[model samples]
Target: MKNKIIGVCPNCGANVVEREKGWFCENRECRFVLWKDNAFFKRLGKRLDYHVADKLLRDGRVRLKDCKSAKGKTYNATVLLSCEADGRSKFSLEFEGGC
Candidate 1:
């Protein structure tokens, strides 16, 4: 099997590598945890379950919202996956109103 390095993690900002065991973050302290589970998903009206979230995380695909960095900057991010050491998740968003 062949693995590809996709660069650093977006959540923790640590290096991410594709290995035989699948993609794993280089940061030992980091779990590379993706989006929130049941409560969060329900609150956000996401049509996914806990099990699905886990699968998506493993597949490097999860969404994040209302994210604030360590620098105190807040952003409305639509991440396609949780591929960061900073603990950010990936998602696609829909804008209902004018910007």
Candidate 2:
């Protein structure tokens, strides 16, 4: 496969690469990781797929197609990506009326 430009890392601002398991910061100094088995998505009944990772890294946010809410109902929402001062990345969801 050809080299693909995944997106910029939120922590160190380096380029992120897509591997078999997840997206990783190219810079060793950064040590940022976004695992595919992230619990955030698993609880929502979804997988942390490549497309979502790409969007989050590229734009700092991604619109999920469908996700189960706390009520066991499916809904659409935007996921916001942010990095902590300690170089850890996290994800949060925004609903229509703002969760």
Candidate 3:
């Protein structure tokens, strides 16, 4: 059967589907997910939405507006999608020339 394109996993190009809490990759090996309660986005008074998920899945990076800095400052920046050594996803802010 053909898998429906609900969403795409940013890591493995697998199908992603929305669950009660978030979106998850269908492949167990590719455990990429965008959690609604992600602390990073929560701090910014925002939640991970469909657009963010779609962009991260297709493009490896996404530009965000009004993101809160850990130091209690707010700014706009590009968030780069990366995978950790443990096969988990990691997000880091990218500045002018570096992360």
> Please, what is the whole-model Cα lDDT of each candidate in the order they appear?
0.50, 0.82, 0.73
lDDT of 1 by residue, 1-99 (tens): 544544566567676565543355678876663333433444444545444444454555554555554565654544344334344444554332437
Question: How many Å off is the CA of 74 in candidate 2?
Answer: 1.5
TM-score, per-candidate, Cα-based = 0.34, 0.85, 0.75
The candidate with the higher lDDT, 2 or 3, is 2
TM-score of 1: 0.34
Task: Report the alpha-carbon TM-score of model 2 versus the true structure.
Answer: 0.85
Candidates in descending lDDT order: 2, 3, 1
Return the lDDT, model 3, position 2.
Answer: 46
Candidate 2 lDDT score at position 52: 81
Best by lDDT: 2
